[model samples]
Target chain A: MTDQNGPQLTRIQQRNRERILEGALTAFSANGFRGATIDQIAEEAGLSKPNVLYYFGSKDEIHKTLLTALLDLWLAPMLSLDPDGEPLDEVLRYVSTKLDMSRDFPRESRLFAYEVLQGAPHLSEILGGRLRDLVDETVAVLTGWIDEGRLAKVDPHHLIFSIWALTQHYADFEVQVRAVLGPGHDPYAEAQVFLENLFRRMLAT
Target chain B: MTDQNGPQLTRIQQRNRERILEGALTAFSANGFRGATIDQIAEEAGLSKPNVLYYFGSKDEIHKTLLTALLDLWLAPMLSLDPDGEPLDEVLRYVSTKLDMSRDFPRESRLFAYEVLQGAPHLSEILGGRLRDLVDETVAVLTGWIDEGRLAKVDPHHLIFSIWALTQHYADFEVQVRAVLGPGHDPYAEAQVFLENLFRRMLAT
Candidate 1:
């Protein structure tokens, strides 16, 4: 079977591919998939359009590759939700990891935000397949915790949605957050404490 | 003082302006402000480019007008949070109203989402001024509730943030929600119940 991770490449190929993706992310995140052009991406990458095309077949291909890589990294914390571990702790840890991702990778967060806001036309398949699988697995674990009386009973899907909404709000709505918070206000630090308290209150049996 | 809303128009001009705004919402919501063009909006509105320009001075004006109108409606629920009302009930009512807005005005929600995700270049002033003012007023009422032991104590700002995050998620990330919930799943109905339970639990004394 072909690897979902992508085919093997030489170090030079990998480096060039990384450069192209970096540029594409900037373009796509700023202008979105339709507004962004291959020429703009090549200029951002400091490569010729032909050279960029040599590494990735088309704009769609580059976007798919970037999305695949991003979703993998983005979903890592959720995927690591250990069924055998303390349920609330696993959930809280996932929250912290996701908050950190938003802080560290705001561009990636915006890229995904842009895609989803545009109805996720490009991501429906992956969302339906890979994302759904991961969520279903994690939801089963959360439901098991509730059944065992280890956590408060809540809709597993909505609980996960709450976590995502709360954490990603900081990144996806950064402008609104900052504007409302005013100058010099640190939102993420406040968010961490607030979210910890929120989930504790939300999940404690 | 010059009207921030718009100049007065004849009835026909007013009807045409409304049509333009409706079409602009669809175009801007679909492609974001930068990606969308006046020509596309004109075509969407079934107006000539010159006719579209006659109603609104420029593309920025159309976007600004749309955003201005949207924020007014968007903030209405928050503005209605009654200081004299039962605290938890007021909060839950606001939640329900916001969720209803999301379901009924998904395009408006996505338009705002697209702007905020791109750093709210057009909305920073309004967010800082009107939104912050309204939020501050609402927070004072919530703080009063907490002080009176009418509601569980929480960071008022983050509490507001949580409400916005959860309700707007149904609109902004609808594709992801629908994909995971599978075919024929009704997210908003389920979300209304889930959010009510969530806030009740979090806010219970």
Candidate 2:
């Protein structure tokens, strides 16, 4: 657990850290925070458990690291919701971006999903503070749009929730979705069009 | 596990069964299926482990019973999405019903959420077969409404997913939701109006 380098990880150290995080994500995503183990993550990362601990200190540390990293990525789309852009277009683009992340980074999505499912026990502080603050700011931006007559009058908070729920459905329920849609169906394509139409209609004055 | 009463449970038997299932639901919802234990459910139900097993044979059996019961209740609203009724009104009713379930039966909702989160490992057959079959039938009803120009054209599958995600969001993310909405905010009332507007707009031709 000693940081001999003291705040300066070497290039190789950075690579190893990334490797450990990547493996931890996969393990944690599959088995969840409570179900996943240090051994499994270490094995997945192709490192000894002691070496994994050497870099991350403990299981909780690794989980917290992955969670913080995932939160940053997950909130990026919402953070990009442009106040100056066309309201419906901005909302639709945000939905599209979230769906794309679901497809591209399902593990991260599931890991976040699992954490939230367990009542956000591990990340309650982050949820209450950082996440809530960001949502409040975004809601203000959305309210501004509605006031400017760029978007239909709607509860901005619920609108954001709708966007989040619809986009994340494809990733979180991929197994059931794939089964029902059949192998030929493209959920992302269908989702993009469906969400655009949904928000457009919802926001149309 | 034997039905000595022949074709129906006695009042006492039914009482015990309900107690066990309710306790199991609470434990499973909190800790998840794999994380839960029969002994814990037994203790929660205030019955000996052997007595709990007497009603439900095994942990798998207890889980299956709870899940099957939940599936029935969960699908009741969707099943009632009447082709005979006005399209938008019917869908709105369904949305409200689902949101109400999330508020009143959050433990049941969370149990199912956990099961689906874990890939529905034990209920894949139910999800893939019975669940998909029901969705197909519901999709046909929606398609008929669209074909008749009673509702706006949209992908039925994605529409179903949207309904599910929005309604279930209150239960699955209750912690974050409650925190963000503040202690006094009524999520159900807000959800009811929000969903009504959301689906109404989405389905309006």
Candidate 3:
């Protein structure tokens, strides 16, 4: 995971790297990057501190590695927003895909949340560069749809933000959600229904 | 602010407490509770550590105090959703008011985000008890509106959660929003219009 074009690692090396990242995700999500330690991450990963360091040069490298990987996963949903598809269906798919990520990759969601909450110290450059470009492209698609009267005219950027905020809230504030929801309620299932109706109603031309 | 029923504090005492809380807000927002320390809070507060201790018995007390205060502020928008008002208008007003809070109280938003992100160790009880009860009451009102055909039928709880998720994103994710929007864009002002239109269209019977 360190070098994009680096030599392929052995099977054992691959498994160990995955384990370390999974452990780092848990530790960093529970404790912010500043509060997390390499020893703690090593313990979480079930590798010795020295062994963990053997894969990554420092804690910063581990964090950056985790974030770099997460950014790609995070970008997948937006990247898949098909510009040539039926506009409403395309957006509904994007919303559902993002919600699925929140449910399936909750740790990744919280880890990213923590990073952004602390001013995105590691993510600022990417947020301005790659992320900005991606949103711009998606916005253009939405604008095209609006121009054709295929979708309602709303601020497309804020529309994307709304999808993100609603979907991620279920994961990021899972405890509060579960507590308020009490027992027996499937929050995500209900949210899926709610969000579909919401975007559908709001986006109908 | 510590003891609500206690004797009133002198003006100087009140100012000192406010200063400490302001500083703690910055520290805790930047660094989660575990990452923060008395010395850091004191340094941020511009008080001696002993002085900080003198005002608040422990770091936990200060954090709890800040949260307690923030909770009241957070609840105000929802609390003010008058049952007698036009249902759609009430909801739109609620969204606009919440967006306003995000603009005026970004630090408080981030502080609360940090606490909740870490599972709200200091706030679990309130989440299940008071917060749950408040939401139940609000949801009841929303359900009543839907039954009366005053508002569009939707999952009232998820509706509230959507409002929260959408509004809070601007504040909690302010840096990312700012970066993506680039310069010269007023995110909150733009958000206010977008949200008002969103809830209005979604909730109209």
Per lDDT, the best of the predicted structures is 3
Question: In DockQ terms, which candidate is top?
Answer: 3
TM-score per prediction, in order, is 0.94, 0.93, 0.96
Pairs that clash in candidate 1: none
Q: Is the docking of candidate 3 incorrect, acceptable, medium or high quality?
A: high
Ten contiguous residues with the weakest lDDT in model 3 chain A: A1-10
Cand. 3 TM to true fold: 0.96
Q: For candidate 1, what is the TM-score?
A: 0.94
Tens digit per residue, CA lDDT, model 1, A15-87: 8888999999999987778768999999999999999999999989999888877887788889889899998
Candidate 1 chain B, run of 10 with poorest lDDT? B1-10
Best by TM-score: 3
Q: Output the better candidate (2/3) by TM-score.
A: 3
Across residues A129-163, which tens digit of lDDT does each residue of candidate 3 receive?
Answer: 99999999989989999999999999988998998
Candidate 3, position A89, lDDT: 92
lDDT of 2 by residue, B1-205 (tens): 3334357887978889999998999999988877788999999898999999898889999999888877788888889988899898899988999999999999988888777777888789888788889999999999999999999999999999888899998888888787776677888799889889989988989
Task: Put down candidate 1 lDDT per residue, B1-205, tens digits, no spaces.
Answer: 2135556767888788888999999999888987789999999999999999998999999999888877778788998888899998999999999999999998888898888887788888888998898888888999999999999989898899999999999999999999998988799999999999999989999
Query: Which rank order by TM-score, best down to worst?
Result: 3, 1, 2
